[model samples]
Target chain A: MTYTFHWEVPLQNLPLFLWGALATLEISGIAVLLGLLIATCGALARLSKHRLLRGAATVYVEVIRNTPFLVQLFYVYFGLVVVGINLEAFSVAILTLTINCGAYCTEIIRAGIQSIHRGQTEAGLSLGMTQWQVFRYVILMPTLRVVWPPLASQFIATMLGSSVVSQISAEELTYAGMFLESRTFRTFEIFFAIAILYFVMARLFSFLFSLTGQKVFREAWGQL
Target chain B: MRRHGRSWGWIAVLGIVLALAWTASASAAESTLDQVLKRGKLLVGIGLGAPPFGMYDADKKPTGYDVDLAKLIAEELKVEIEWVDTTSVNRIPYLLTNKVDLVIATFGNTPERAKQVAFTKPYSSWNLVLLGWKKDRNIKSYKDLKGKTVAVTRGTTQDIAITKLAPEAKIVRYEDDPVAMLAFEQKKADVMPTAEVLALKKVKENKDMEIKGLVSRSWAAIGVRRGDPDWLQWLNTFMDWHGGQGKFAELFEKWNGVQMPVALPRW
Candidate 1:
């Protein structure tokens, strides 16, 4: 049946939908931020000379990579209670997302760290630069160039994955659609609007990432 | 050359990491239900969109006939009701997977469904009712549906009714009931067929629609997972007492403005 484009939702509950959208963004953004921090640490650990640090990093990468994100999220969100590590729902959402995204970012960033070319590291070492200086000066900038796109994409994925947080009542965008459908009994309309909101958010994120990449990697040979 | 070597190493690292995670889950072999109930609330699986049966309110508190009704059942079970909102496509899988203890969502009883789960005797009955513009006086009966398009919820009895009674008529399948009601309001179709009480409620709530036919009644029952005879029997008896007494009838009239169908036998 044809329906009019409703100018106003009957209950005047547009704010719920908007609030849900913002929550989705916040969760995804927080996850991506913390995930980046974790990925750096894990990537560094993998490069460590000590077997324990390297082995631990290796185990983390293998386990997180193979499992489904849904299963992992459930484990982190629900399993914490078994160990008496009680966390709020929002905290779980952010934590699960950070862990899930971290493993992937570790792989991508490790490649960037490794791609600094032996010549550059040798050049830094010959100039009496410490290992730390070589890593920061030679490795960090080069790796950032190669990994920026995937990092942006990972953040975008975090945005979508935040929907799973609805299972734990994080009250994100999909949760808003759920709330609206319940109240309005306008299930299809509510979901349709939600899908549109997600689409717009994803597009906006991609646009921002593209702009940021241009600024960060403008000197890369591919651009020239 | 070194760049290619590192990329290949990363791939190997990725492979090993995944295998370890899989091993842990394989060994755990725990149930999702035990985990949920231990948290002290029964996580109910329901299609929060289907109204009068399930769904929530503007305040984000779940409120509907199904929500209220389920709250009663939860109170009796002495467990807090924690809703796990789902879609129509997800309900059965949710129950069989033990994501919910029971569903008070308005699932019509069918012989096919009996294979998958146990059902309490119907606490409510719903029928396909045709709705039209309030001023449209002539199109009040199912017989009037010939040669005209009708709007129905996809995959429901309304779709079946349209296909069976007026095969020549075009049927527009909306995703849910309220959408169909909106379609009827917009004159998108001459009539919309839905659960009678829901159609009546929408007609009263909206400025434009009217309910025309009571059509046919289908049994709406609470379902439990199959093989749980003890739970099943308890639910059947609970429904019988609460709904059989005048209390159920009084609530039905007070909130919904209709009586339980008399022909349906008690559990």
Candidate 2:
């Protein structure tokens, strides 16, 4: 109750916090790119003519989406070590984030692909386009436009969820906050600053996604 | 609509901050001891994560050295005991925020920590050591810890000590003792720095680990909010009185299955 706010503690440790923020962005950025790749493959697999590919994709998505992310992280980081599969905390963090984000993004992407009318695919084929070209030009482009908002939200969620990686000492923004809080015992001040940093990061991600959407879609942006 | 929602979010945050300030100011007038006496209940924080010192028993009830000590303190105050489970990192914040009147959570007394929370005279004592697999004789001293992954509970005495002493050791800090110990057990880390008693317990359960190096002999004490001289003094006197009666030693033996290693000094 008689506590004094040490605003200087966080201010003095700005460099460390910045380094941690960079780590957060680095991990999340890598995860987002890898996750999107996995989601694309997974979406294609789920819609594939091969039953085996569809079944495997379904299992992967269901297994990841059903279980808690923390448990999955622990399994990769801690549980795997018991069987001689030791990995660094940062590597485990990125690995888990990629898989977790991949699972959710797969569902979103699959829904987007499914939303394309069968007539559009038939129309592309009738126009003398190859299968890959039609899939890319007709299905993929419109799918991106349709699912961009949800994918952006999922990407932001993954970035926010990266804070839990600090539990394994991954040295991200939340880890930096914890390190400062441990030293200064300024819990509220440290976490409050961290929350603001996360907010800024999320906003930045949203802005980047919109710019990307507009650039990629071009004239199709508003028309879609 | 977006601007309207944004303004409402700011207003909500302001409201919460003002509420916190109001409660902090209101509680500032009375010392923790006065509050406990007036409320007829002693709110004590204990870490259930650390075994022997603080843990659950066969019945899943909280029963450990720290818990027993807290019970004794509450009895001395003639008040009902209410336990607030805390972890290594949150112990000090719990005291600072008035969530608990005192924390007896295997909190090692350190000069750095003393700045945040007042510590009574030591009620218990233990040595911290770098524990690793018996097969890894390469880790014999602090210098040997170079490039090795050392797991520790975040914000604990051993975490700070190892970070300072063996700066080159890759420290992977978990949120609590159990998680860090689990990481060590799983071999996620090459070594773990923790209480000697905890290390010995682990070594007994699995024949692989042994003490690699000693970090420091630490004294555990009750933590109270800083600036509460009245509460701090009362706790010091309570520890001295009960400690002189060998009650703490008896509880230590009962919970830890060993005699007290170091005689707690009375100032």
* Candidate closest to the true structure, highest lDDT: 2
Candidate 2, residues A73-99: lDDT per residue as tens digits?
878888787678888889999999999
Cα misplacement distance, residue A126 of candidate 2 (Å): 0.3
Write down the TM-score of every candidate. Answer: 0.49, 0.93
Scored by Cα lDDT, where does model 1 land? 0.70
Each model's DockQ score: 0.02, 0.54
DockQ of 1: 0.02
Instruction: Report the C-alpha lDDT of model 1 over A1-224, residue by residue, as the tens digit.
Output: 01222326523777887898898999888888888889999998988899999999889999999998878766775566668776655787888888888888998898888876789889988989899988776777668777888888888887987887765445688866764443333443465567667877987898898897787666553432
The complex in candidate 2 yields a DockQ of 0.54
lDDT of 2: 0.87
Taking the candidates one at a time, how many backbone clashes does each contain? 6, 0
Candidate 2: stretches off by over 4 Å: A219-224, B1-26
Clash list (residue pairs), candidate 2: none
Model 1 residue pairs with clashes: A62-B16, A62-B17, A62-B18, A63-B17, A66-B18, A182-B56
**What would the per-residue lDDT of candidate 1 be over residues B155-174, giving only the tens digit for each residue?**
45566556677777766555
lDDT of each: 0.70, 0.87
